[model samples]
Target chain A: MAKMNLLQAINSALDLAMAKHDNVYSFGEDTGGFGGVFRATSGLTEKYGKHRNFNTPLVEQGIIGFANGLASQGSYAVAEIQFGDYIFPAFDQIVNETAKFRYRSGNEFNVGGLTIRTPYGGGIAGGHYHSQSPEAYFAHTPGIKIVTPRNPYEAKGLLLSAIFEKNPVLFMEPKRLYRASTGEVPEEEYTIPLGKADVVKEGNDITVLGWGAQMEVTEKAVEKAEEDGVSCEVIDLRTISPWDVETVTQSVLKTGRLVISQEAPITGGFASEIAATVQDKCFLYLESPIARVSGIDVPYPLCHEKEYMADHLKIYEAIKRSMNY
Target chain B: MAKDKKHNTEIVTKPKWFDKDSVTIPMLQILKEDGSFHKDADMPAYDKELIVKIHDTMQFIRILDERMIAAQRQGRISFYLASRGEEAASVASAAALDFGDMIMGQYREQGALAYRGFTVEQFMNQLFSNEKDLGKGRQMPVHYGCADLNFMTISSPLGTQIPQATGYAFGQKMDKTENCTICYFGEGAASEGDFHAALNMASVYKVPVIFFCRNNGYAISTPAQGEQYGGDGIAPRGIGYGMKTIRIDGNDAFAVLKATQEARRLAVEENEPVLIEAMSYRMSGHSTSDDPTGYRTREEEAEWQAKDPLDRLQKWMMNEGWLDKDHVEEHHAEVKAKVLAALKESEKVPVPHIDELINDVYDEPTDMLKEQLDELKDHMRKYPDTYSKTSGRLD
Candidate 1:
């Protein structure tokens, strides 16, 4: 085992997947020698040569659409969308074709064995252009799996799982945590099952659930609750779509309270989904109504990064509200 | 249909329809104007049953277009896109392929889906966005995907399917499946960068893929005359890609089937990619949401209707005694009953279960997804009076 960051784990997974499968190739804007703007694909071109890892045009539509074609033919493709904000151009390809290819053609043509890696979520003052939490859009879609990792260990495990899975996957990486987050990741091959949540810190008072970058914020909130003589269980939801309701429900049932957090807007945010699930599954056990800590229902503010984020203070406040109820 | 000369608009003249240019392939027409077979034509042999099948499918498609469009107007369905005058192109090309071959179609190629034996019930279920839709009522109407049929779901965006088809064909080549992927798109989609990349990749790798272009005169409001490249419709570009290419009379079933069958042979057996350009007309609005009267003329529509592919095929079938007038009427009635019954069932089908929204993306639902599903359940419970029926099924 070795300690790694989100960026390191992602690169390692790509390297391993490419090495293991000859048909696994990758392409996107500046993914070749430049190794992507974040270097997630850094050193891949040098390692596997340009044929397997190369740069594509500046067109996102072309990149994903081409990946759809390549993946359809039995090639395992991991296409990069430069930033989550710019992925809209390729949304049609993902939502219309790649996601539903299996079910629409009655499983006649499926791109299930493909992965789309893109950086998303807000925190590094990227404003509206570079930062966004668009996973909900994909999570709303069927046929495609959506996953995001909070730490290096989960990153490596989930990436491996996504590579080998027999369905298309939207692998979102929180750019703000690429180098900031780290954990001990195994050196050899291993995979974490998708649709599972890890209880990072267990307590009896309440359950704090979040994913991607917000999971760290959620941990801070739990810590504050602990300092305030309030015990809280914090769970990191590593994947978004097909998320783990069983763990959350079980935790909430024991705690009798829940607080959901996300960096996306409050309305129709991923948190809403979680809140709904908790109410249904553990309604009888609940001592308090579910509380959500989310970004304002407005475009990410350019000058107010701290305010726009569902940071420690907000999560703490949400938890306090849920506990009081 | 005679080429319009009154406009005298020679935007870019490289190759006229019938002229021989190594750079530009002519529209392969097996049946001459007099309805006689052409000499030196490598056409597909069509027995009486196959001809009737092709004609029946076309007639059913036309009826489907009428009924569905009317249903949309009546608010029975959300939206629809008709195959209309392009029936021959889609049906003929689809008929030419092996049963196992893959079909990647744009939204307008309903005829191809129908030809693949996609039942009227399936079409209605998808159009009605009901629970029975294989898509689980997740997609907008007209975006049909059938897993068992091997017909890739129709995507609304113009050219996304081009590269997807290429990638799928690459898989076929790897598996040694001897099955080629035929991607159907309008000439306008040729302008998209995906089209260029797919062609380049398929050519370089020599993947088993057929790039089928239905040049139906217009892509929405943009006509093919100006919207497509200057040389000649879209055939020369195929030649420029260094792949075998052919242009065919889109209204002539014999020509389209002949060209497509040969293209599939080269694609599957030889691992060679090919492009087939079907010259046709858009006899209806691009879709239910569009109003073609704004850009096109009735005179133009009338002239194109005179060259109706179904009528010509019917003439041939009737002349050959393959189908009688009474049989045609009976077939129409039978297809109508099926389409109507499917429509009624689809309209009554409920939306997919709420829990299904979180399923299928992974082996099991993740914590975040669980949370979301929980939230929805809470909303439904909170508004208990609003969700009494829906909530009861939670168990």
Candidate 2:
């Protein structure tokens, strides 16, 4: 095992997958020799040879289309979208072609060997274009698995599992935690089962649920809530689609209250989905209504990043509200 | 942006408008109208088996289009798109490639699919959306795909496969397979952003992909002349991207075969992407939903009907003693009968079970999918009149 950041762990996972399978290819804008804008694919071109790992023209739709076509040939395509915000250009390909490739063809053709990796969430102060969490948009799309990781260990495990999952997967990496989040990761290959939620901390008063960078924020909020004589259970939802309902509902049933947070807008945010589902399952068991502490339904602001974000303070306030009710 | 090289050739003393019509790319027409070749034309070097296959696929497409249009009239299928006049543009080009090469065709390229060995039964099953259909009744009629045959599925969205072909060919190059890929789309589809994105990327990446643009006169209701582009067709776009480009008489089967053969050579031998613009006409309406009288003139349709690709190919083959009138008649009759039989047999087969509805959403249905399926089934059971009458599987 080695101590690595989220980016390193992701790179290690790509390296491991490419090493294990020659058919595994990784490419995108600036993802080749430059190792991506975030260097998430560093050293891959040299290690795997430029043929398999190379740069593509700066067209997001082209990248996804190319990846889909290659994956249709029974190859593993690991396509990187430069930024989650830029992935909109490829939205039709993902929602229509990639997701429906298997379903539309009745399993005769599939891009199941394809994994689309994009960095999501806001923290770098990169403004609108770079800082955005688009996971909610894809989570609503069926036929594709959506996975996000909170830390280094989870990043490596979930990413490996996505590549081998036999269904097109959208792996959203929390760019905000690329370097800020680090931990010991096993060098030996491993896979974390998708659609499973990991309970970071056990508590009985209230459940704080989030994924990716929000996991850390929720953990901090749980600490703040503890000071207020409230015990909160923290859950990291690794897979957004096919999310672990049993684990989350069980957690909500035990705590009798739930607060979900995300960087995306609250209106159609993934947090809203979780909050709605929790209320439906634990309706009679609830002491307070489900609270969604997420970003406002506006463009992500560059200057007011702290205020716009559902930071620990905002989540802490929401947890206190859930407890007060 | 295209004038930097002009400055190097000569200093501009006075401002002048560039004449777009100054350059005209000639269409490659080896086979002339009356069953003979142009004076200096060379016969395309193809095995007799391949020539026969291309001819047979064209005949198959002609029969399929005619009967399927009648089928649509009878309300047997929801929709159909006929490759009416652009047969050689699709089939001959398909005949030039190896079976390992990938074919990403638009909806009208059933000729190419047939050339790649898609059977009449498979075509009928897809059109009927029966249980035996490879698409599992998921897509509408005319959307066909066979991965085993290296033919990517037909998609409704125009030009989405253009960039996809570049990526697929890039994989072929990476695998060192000594193969190439062919992407087909119409002049109307060229207006899509994917067309520009695909051309620029294929050229920049130097992937072995042939972008075959069937410059059929209309894109549904939009004419290609002033609507699609102002410049000389899609051929110049290829030159602008610094790749080999060719324009061919799409109705001339020999020209299409020769152009594609040369393009494949450049692709597989040198890893160079090539673009071939085949000039043809959409003799029929875009799909069954359209009516040509709404947008085009009868005189215009008559002009292209005279250049019917099937008739031209038959004339050339007969003049060369490669075909007999009796054999050709027998072949057409056989194709019609076989297509009708397949249509009758396939439509009688039941549609896929209701369980298949949620099967390929993923390798295994998720909990959400399973729960949703249960809810749907209960809802269907409650309201059987609307579904069971047509599907006959609610119970």
Candidate 3:
């Protein structure tokens, strides 16, 4: 086992996946000699040569299209969109082509070995341009899978799974947590199955559900709640698309209350989906209405960074509000 | 990876740099514009039955377009895009390819799908957005996909399918299949970043894919002259990407077939990517929702009408003694009847079962999806009058 940052873990996963399969290649804007904006593909082109890893025109649609081409060839492709916010240009490729290939083709043709890597979320004050949680848009799209990680260990494992999965995987890396989030990860190859959640802390009063950078805030909130003599169980939902409803439901059933937290806007966010699910499946056990602590419905605001952002303090207040009844 | 500067210059050689024959492939014609054959020029000598069959399909598609456009105007449908002047580009190209070869199409290639045996009923079913529709009303009209026919569904975003075709063609090569994927887009779509990316990858990997561009003079209101940069059209960009390239009169069905045939030979046998630029015109509005009179003059439309692809094909049939006025009128009437009946039936059919909305996403719907489905069902049950049209058995 070794300790590494999310960026290094992601780079190692790419290197391992590419070195293991000659058909595996990578490319994006600055993904070649520059090793990507985040250096997730650092040293890949130098070692694998340009045929496998290279830089491309500053076009997101092209990068995705090229990746789709490689994937169709039975080649595993790990493509990067400079940032998550810019991926909308390639939305046609992801939502229209990549997502519907199997269903449209009557299961005759599908892209099982493709992964799109992008950095998402806004804790680093990336402003509106660089920061976004667009996973909800893709998660709603069928035939595509979504996975985001909070720590290096989950990042490496989930990425490997994404690389090997038999469908298009939108892997959103938390840009703010690339270095802020670190943990011990095994050098040996392993994969964390998608559609599962991890319970970081055990308690009975309420289930504090969060993902990506928001997991850190939820942990802080749990600590503060503990100091207030309010025990809370914190669950890190690593995969947001095929979210681990089983884990979340079981926790909700036991805790009898839920405080769903995410950095995305509260309206139409992942939190809303989870809240609706808790209301349906565990309503009988609920002591209070499910609460959501999230960014406002407004777009990731550039003018009031601290005021609109979700953090431990906001999470604590929401939890208190849910417990008031 | 090495940028071939000389090769690039050679591809961009202006038409002024070459004689007419050097630039334009001699169009394959069974008849002249006056409905008479040249005695000396070599002909492929297609059988009478096959010639009539091709004519029948073309006439049927033309009639279908007329009715569908009328339906859209009547507000029975949301939108419609017609092949209009470019039917030959689509129909003849489809006839040339093997059924197993994949097709990734833009909105205008319904002629290709119709020629490939996509039933008129299936077309109406999808267009009317009914239960029989393969997409189950999930998509807007013209976004057709048929798995059994190997035509990938049409996407709305311009040029997005270009790279996807490359990827799917690569998969065919990997499977050691003789099939190739044909992606059809307009010259307007060629300017998109995806087009450049798709061609670059297809050339680099030598994927068995054909990038078919219908360089139809305009992208809606923008004329090809100012909107795109290829002096000769989209063909040069294919060469720039190191792929095999060809240009042809898209209105000539024979030319489209010949170009696509040779392109298929390279893609299937040589694992090469080929780009075929079909010089054609968009005679109708970009969509039923558009008004082309705002941008183009009647003179421009009249000029293209003189080169009408349907008339040219009919002339060729007449010269071959394959079709006459009576036969043409009868075939036209028969196709109209078929389209009208299909449209009536399709509009009457119900939408897909409500449960179908949540099915096929996973082996089993996730608990969350199930929960959501339940909530929707409960909401419907509670408000039966509100959802009376859709609250039926789930498929």
Candidate 4:
């Protein structure tokens, strides 16, 4: 095992997938010789040749549509949308075509082997365009899987699984954690099943749930609560759609309290879905009303981003309120 | 306005490199509307049997369009789109390609499907959305697809298929196969951003694709003259992309066939992308919901009706001693009768089973999907009388 950052783990996963499967290829704007804007695909062009790994024209729609076409013909396409903010131009392709390909064709045709990788979430001072958590938009769509990894080890395993999934997947990498979070990743290839939640810490007082960069915020909050003699169980929901409801519900049932955190706005965020599910499933075991610590419902501000972010203080406050109740 | 001294040193002069008004690419017309050929134009190498097959397919499509439009008027079907006047652009281009070549169509290319041997029965099943329909009633009528024929399903989005075609052809190139892809779109769809993106990618990559634009005068109700663009139609845009482009008389079957044949050769042999802008007209309303009279005069409709591709082909066949006027009328009547019979038979078939609604969402339905489907079935069972289709046996 070797300590690797999230970007290195992602590159290793692509290398492993392409080495094992000749049909696998990658394309996106600025993804070729320049690696990527984040260097998530560095040196893939030299190793695999341009036929498999190449830079595409700077058109998100074209990139996604081309990937869909390639996947329809029995090829595994791993496409990158440079940033999550620029993904709206390709929304029609993903929602109308990629998500609906199998359903409309009645299994006679499908683009099942497509993986779209994009870096998202705030906390990097990237301003509005470069720092958006658009996972909820894709989670609402059926026939597509959505996953967000918390650290490098999880990133490698989840990305490998997403590539092998027999349906389109939106693999959202938390850009803030690309280099900030490091963990020992396996030297050999491995996969962690999607839709599974990882319990970072187990306790009986209250349950704190989060994912992506928010997981780091959640850890700090849990540490602070522990200092005050508050025992909390922290969970990172590795996948959004087809989420591990059983894990969260089971933990909430044992803990008798719940606090959800996210970087997206509070209204209609992925946190809302988790809160609703936990409340519905663990209503009888409740000790407090379900609480959410999330960004305010506004555009991500540049200057006052710290105030806008769901920082550790907000998470800590939500945990204290839930524990008190 | 003041210019910087460094920039002011370079003088500005008008360059005559290209003319905006001039039609740089001439339209190829082997057969005129009156069945006369240009003396200098070489006839396409089409045999009598193939010519008759193309003619019959065009006539079948024309009759099918007329009958389906009437059916919509009588409230038999929900909607219909007629490829009324652009038969040559669809059938002849399809005739020019090999069976292995891929076809990614917009809405109005049923003639290509018919040319690829999509039967009258198959057409009716799709229109009626019966259990036998290949698409399993997932799409609206006329949104057709056939995997067996290498024809991608027709998506309702305007120009999404253009970029998809380029990518599919890139796959074909990677496989080193002799096949190429032909993508069909109207002049209106060409205005979409995907169209430009796809064309630029195809040219940059030198992918094997033939971009077939059916400039059928109007995109729904907007005329191609002032509303579409200020340039000389869509061919010059292809030239601007450094693609081998040609403009042809879409009503003349021979011209379309010849152009597509050459385009396919260039695409397969040289890994080059080609664009063919076929000039034609939409003789009918855009769809059953549209009334062309609201936008254009009946006189204009009549003018396009005179240039009907089927009529031009019929006249040419008659001049070549392949078909007479009475024979053509009898053939039309026979096609009408066959289509009417198929429509009646297809409508009697049951709708797709309710379980089909949840079948293809994934390789296998997840546990959650199965639970939801079961709940739906239970609800339908309790209200069986309200769900008419539930009376039939479900898979």
Model 2 alpha-carbon miss at residue A323, Å? 31
Model 1 has a DockQ score of 0.03
TM-score of chain A of 2: 0.99
Over 4 Å off in model 3, which ranges? Answer: A1-87, A90-325, B1-45, B392-395
Per-candidate Cα lDDT values, in order, are: 0.82, 0.85, 0.80, 0.86
- Show pairs that collide, candidate 4: none
- Looking at model 2, residue A57 earns an lDDT score of 52
Backbone clashes in model 2, listed as residue pairs: none
Model 4 residue runs over 4 Å out of place are A1-325, B1-19, B391-395
Candidate 2 positional error at B299, Å:
0.7
Candidate 1: how many backbone clashes? 41
True contacts kept of each: 0.03, 0.00, 0.03, 0.00
**Candidate 1 lDDT, A95-129, residue by residue in tens:** 99998899889878989778999999887645455
**Model 3, span A1-325: residue lDDT tens:** 8889999999888888887889888887657655766678878878999788876654678778878877877889888887898788899999998999889989887887889999998865454556788888998898888998888998999999999999889999999898887889888788999878999888999899998888888888889888988889999998888888999999999999899888887668888888888899998899998888776554453323444467777788778877787
lDDT of 1 at B9: 60
Q: Model 2, A15-118: lDDT tens per residue?
A: 99999999999998657665776789889988999788876654577789999999999999999987888788799999999999988888899999999999
> Relative to the unseen true structure, what is the C-alpha lDDT of residue A200 in candidate 4, on a scale of 0 to 100?
91
Q: Higher DockQ: candidate 1 or 4?
A: 1
Second chain alone, TM-score for each candidate: 0.90, 0.95, 0.89, 0.94
